[model samples]
Target: MKALLKRGFNLLDSLFSRAFTPAWNPLYQLGALSFFYFWIVAVTGVYLFIFFETSISGAYSSIEQITHGQWYIGGVMRSFHRYASAAMGICVTLHVLREFAMDRYSGPRWFSWVSGIPLLWLLFASAIGGYWLVWDQQAQYIAILTAEWFDALPIMVDPMASLFLNESTLSDRFFSLLVFLHIGIPLALLLGMFIHIKRVTAPRSNPARGLAAGTLLAMLAVSLWRPALSQAPANLDMAVTEVGLDWVFLNPYPLINSWGPGNTWVLLVGLSTVLCLLPWMPSRRPKRTPVAVVDPDNCNGCGWCLADCPYEAVSMKEHDFKKGHKQSVVDPDLCVSCGICAGACPSSSPFRHVDELTTGISIPELHIKELLARTEASLAKLSTDQPRIMLYGCDHGSVVPDIQSSTVAAISMPCAALVPPAFVDYVLRQDLAEGVLISGCCEGDCFHRLGNTWVDQRFSMERMPVLRTRVPRERVRLRWLGAQGTRALQREVVEFQRELAEAPALIDLEDVSSG
Candidate 1:
């Protein structure tokens, strides 16, 4: 099932990439787009509230006035509020599904996945409350159905639906209560949104400026084309047999009608429970996942690991052996076992003279020494007569083995970021490979969240452990082709080989060492 969904997402991503570019692709920016739509909903909701009436008798008339009298501004605001809310729901749902399809909602990511479930309910509640405030026939139908739905719960002794039994039973107080809830629930949803991204190192809560502007313009065009208008005023004496519905929020009403309120409640609760437990449903972890380990002897309290970790798993504390100094600590529970911290550690340099070649921070299973040995072995197998290229890829991105050839060698890491910059320099200086190609997850859609970003920054000399300025920039290439980008990776490798063929010979390392 997951494989099928991932393929579908890859196909969509490829199509969207051509239209919006990878950086501005809506699929990649789903989470941020949700935030964008939410702000639109909030700003327009505030404007609508300023002119809203809280009484049942006045609510419908005020809405009618806003729809017709202030058609240019208030009417547009109302439509923006309605449509933006719907867009938010759609974005949130896609964000969840995309995360699941990519298998990112497990292990250390479980907290984000679990925290997001409550947000769906809160969003629906807020939208439903807003509909009721319109006090139209559609709202009337929603109110009565919602009341009956609640009455099915075991905790409700008094039938809440009885409040709408007759024209005299309903009160303005009930209308005011709905107004309060509509405001309060969204505020709560905002808080949940914060908690959802708290563990992420640097969460992107806003989409690109171009994407944001485009979305807003599209929403405006929609509002202008089909302005949101209310139906006739609610009448308890008349039966609500038919009325227009916003399926985004009122989708469950059909289920409630077809499967009884009790059955619908059961279905909703069961679905929520399943989503919350998905992270642990089958356990995606390996038999033994290796976490980053600190070598206090080599550690100088640099704090690079703490900064590079996508999860807040690394911290600093007073060193036990070196008094007054600090050492890095890894929280076992929070660590996702990504080797990005290993790459960030300056001590991970391949030039280290020590026999064991230990680093300040390194993954236990794939230490710096083991990585260098693997790189050397892989390069040794390549033909030196040709333009040898060392291709480094991550487990979650391009399939490295598929692109290996007599002249091109491949090394797969837990993440491309795990390849220390020094390794790239070492490979060139030793003439092991004429060029080094680093490929990983698609731009803006890293499976480990920040792996590819950190790799790019390090290579560009914008971050710590910078790639040496002496090294030829043309010899090092970084391509962010996604997991399904095997063919793309092959094409990039061939292109890099051609570029290296035309470039001048590598610098003389022997002369530099003697100088």
Candidate 2:
């Protein structure tokens, strides 16, 4: 089932990528777009609120005045409010579906998926309350059915539907409740949105500037092309036989009306429960990598490891042995075991003796010492005569292109971010290989989030654990490729080798020991 859904999503992704370049693909920016749409709805909603009257008698006419009286600004605001709400509904639904399809709702990601479910309910209720404020035929249909749906529960003394039987039965108090819900539900949704992205290292609530501008323009075009107007004022005396519905939020109403309130409740509750439990539904749980461990003996209290940890799993505290220095502490539960902290530690330089190369922070499975040993072992197998090149590949990305020739050898790391800048310098300085090619999951699509991005920044000397300036830039090349782009990676590697051969200059090895 997961594979089939992923295939469908991939097709949609391809279409969007073709229409708007991959950088601006709406499919990839669903979460950010949903947040952007909320801003649009909020701004337009404020404009409508200035002139909106909440009482039963005034609600309908006031909305009509806003729709037709001031067609230039007020009408546009109303249209924007309506269309942006619909766009948010679409964006949030697609975002949820895409996360589920990719199995991102499982394991450590369950918190985000579960938090978002209640956000969906809050958005639906908020939109429904907005509809009621219009007090039109469509709103009337929704109000009646909605009241009936709620009255299905036995707890209510008088069915909510009883309030709408006649004009005398309804009051401003009821409309006040509608207005309260319209404002209150969205406030709750804002809180839920925060919780939804709480686990992410750096949540991208806002999209690229270009994408934002494009979306706003598209919304404007849609609003101007087909202006939103209120239906005929709601009349209690007349029956609503025919009315246009905003199916996005009103979808459940038809099911409730057709299948009866009891079945509708059953369907909604059952679906929500299943979605909430999706994380544990799979037969087998994914294996988690070993978390980082702090070595107090080697720790100098420099705190560089704490600064580099993306998950906030590393904390700095007073150390017993080093009075003035602070030691790094690891929170096992919060760590994703990316091994970036080890790379950030200055002691991770492999130029030191094998026994002395330990870092203050290191992953249990891929310690710096173990990594150094593995790298040397891999290099030992390669012959010295041919145009030798060391290939560094990411475990989560493309299958390391198997260079069958004796000229090249590859080493795969758990993540591209795990490769320290000194490790690259060590390989070059020791003449383990002629050139090094660092490859990983593409810049925007890292499996371990910012792994590839950080790797690029580190090598470019824009971030910590930077590749020193003395290292010849021409001897090192970085490539970002997705899992399906092994062919491109191979081509780039070959090209890099040719470039290295043409230059054939070595980096200064004397300065590497100082790092």
The TM-score between candidate 1 and the true structure equals: 0.97
Candidate maximizing TM-score: 1
Model 2 weakest lDDT span, ten residues long:
504-513
Off by over 4 Å in 2: 8-28, 282-284, 353-356, 383-386, 401-405, 507-515
Q: Which pairs clash in model 1?
A: none
lDDT digits (tens) for residues 1-515 of candidate 2: 87787668766765666677656778767898899989888889889989988799889989889988998889889999999899999999988887877656766677888888889889999899999899999988999999999999888778899988977788988888888888889889888898899977777788778889988898788878888998888887787999999999989988888999989989988899889888778563456778998888878888777766766678899985877888899888777777878888877888766555787789987888888887788887888665578787877665674643576777676677788899889888888877888887655656666777778888888888799997788888887765555777888778877787777456434445455
Give RMSD (Å) of candidate 1 vs. truth: 1.8
lDDT of 1 by residue, 152-207 (tens): 99999999999999789999899788888989999999999999999888999999
What's each prediction's TM-score? 0.97, 0.90
Candidate 2: what lDDT?
Answer: 0.81
Model 1, runs deviating above 4 Å = 283-288, 508-515
